[model samples]
Target chain A: MRVLGVDPGLTRCGVGVVEGVAGRPLTMLGVGVVRTPADADIGHRLVAIERGLEEWLDTHRPELVAVERVFSQHNVRTVMGTAQASAVAMLCAARRGIPVALHTPSEVKAAVTGSGRADKAQVGAMVTRLLRLAAPPRPADAADALALAICHIWRAPAQNRLQRAVAAQHAQNAPKGRTA
Target chain B: MRVLGVDPGLTRCGVGVVEGVAGRPLTMLGVGVVRTPADADIGHRLVAIERGLEEWLDTHRPELVAVERVFSQHNVRTVMGTAQASAVAMLCAARRGIPVALHTPSEVKAAVTGSGRADKAQVGAMVTRLLRLAAPPRPADAADALALAICHIWRAPAQNRLQRAVAAQHAQNAPKGRTA
Candidate 1:
């Protein structure tokens, strides 16, 4: 199974993809970050995010996408940005009909490091160890994204089966006529 | 003199313009957030930011631009992205040969309120009250941008002096080789 994970942000978004077989060590696929101007208008940044995800998706064609599920926001601006970023990721996956899954920050952290409150450094270290990388991912966000992917690769079921199950659940419970 | 403040991001960016004088309580020339797709390409997003800022600058013809300065980051990924975003803002201002000022988040918060430790909501409330608006800027980042503009206006010298200063400073700090 191949899995792609993303750490969403308005300016800098980290992305990582991993491939492996069930009950076997996962292999590295690809990783990078999509960036936009923090001082540019929001519309511009959104396009950057969309294009970044599209480039990665087109290049990798991973079977699944694992993203950080957006939560509540005290900063409406930050929250809105996060939501928009999430949408872009979803749209990228939807375009190819690829399956997408979301995990909370805590869940990914817990799965990777045995603790939900692990710091970025700790998470980076763990992600490096899990992926058996020669070095830890350079940026904390990139490390976090790698860890999220590892978390899913170690937990997500095999390709068609896992995606189908989640899709069914989401469809059954999805609100009627409400936009994604 | 109306001033437009921009807090740029890849997803949702904050933009606010203030008109009138500093002590006299400026008019809220305008305020809004631009939304971008999260998964969009970073390059496209940057273009969007540039276009949007250019359009706003043309429409408002604000006397000055105030942008947030990014601090150092251990994650080169985020740092690089932020740097790129900030550069776009500077470029937009420079293209118009309009004077641009930058402030750190702390400085912006401090200038808006009495405390640099002020949170987003506090700053938003203060900006709204400072302008005597009907509501707080829904997105705190936009309010913060406006606050930054207001702060710059409050700190800038009189119109005659500012115009003279821009002329003298223009020689040494011109837009050439601005991207570092």
Candidate 2:
């Protein structure tokens, strides 16, 4: 299964594509950051993010998009930007009928480093070793993105069942003849 | 000028359209809520919001879009959803080349009523008076959306100048040959 992981941020959204399934060697397809001007208005910044993400989606065309689930407990100022950027990432994938999955930061770290509280360097080192790259991807965000994809690939079996149940419940509870 | 105001939320996104300038009597073009099922996934919810906002834009053809500025200091769980929804609202407007403006809750309150700390009922009453409506819009979120439109109309003169200066600064500082 091919997966596109997104470590969402307004200033530097990290995106990486990984191809493979659980219990198998994964190939690192690509990794990069989508940057938006800090001085730009939120609307313009969001537009920029959409365009950048579209370019990535056009190039990679991954089957699933995994984004870091944002939590409100982070830095108050940055958390809002994170949430907004994540929304754009998810929207782009969903619009294309690509399944979107959300994984927590700790989950990503644990999947790659065997510890939820692993430092950036450890996670980077582990990602480099796992992907058999000459060096870890530049910018911690890029490494985090790869970690998210790895986490999703390993956890997909369980996550898929949970997602299916949730979708079924939602469909059952939906109002009659209401579009949403 | 006609302004489409959006009070972003995950479950019930309030939208209102108001027409007219600062000193003139305003017209309430429309007011309604765009709701997404609580159990729906984030990507689907965002897609629903985009569709709903697009329909409003198509019907009203508002010159400008006004959305509430979400702050992370609010209810921790709810603030992230608000930010995500607000991002989708801004994206819809920006993609169509319509200028988008953000108004804080306090700013909307102060523009309509005498005080920034005015309660929802007070703002709703003033919105009814300003738009010459028979009754205040139901659902505080709907009233808040109308208040946002009214606020933008009243503050546009000053806000436009500020926005222009900010835009100019951003343009000046932008990297050469760099697209954002």
**Candidate 1 C-alpha lDDT tens digits along A1-180:** 778899888877889998885578778888888888898645345556766777788788787788887654345456446655665665456435566777889999998899999888889888788788999887777887788788887765655486767555544653311121
Per-residue alpha-carbon lDDT of candidate 1 for residues B71-99, written as tens digits (9 for 90 to 100) = 54334345434544555565556545566
RMSD of each: 10.7, 4.8
Query: Candidate 2 lDDT, tens digit per residue, A1-180?
Result: 788999999999999999987888999999999999998778878888888888888898887889999999879879989999999999887666567899999999999999999999999999999999999999999999998998999988677556556545544654312122
lDDT of each: 0.70, 0.86
Give all TM-scores, in the order shown. 0.48, 0.90
User: In order, what DockQ does each candidate have?
Assistant: 0.04, 0.45
Q: On residues B110-149, what C-alpha lDDT tens digit does candidate 2 reach at each position? A: 9999899999999999999999899999898999999999
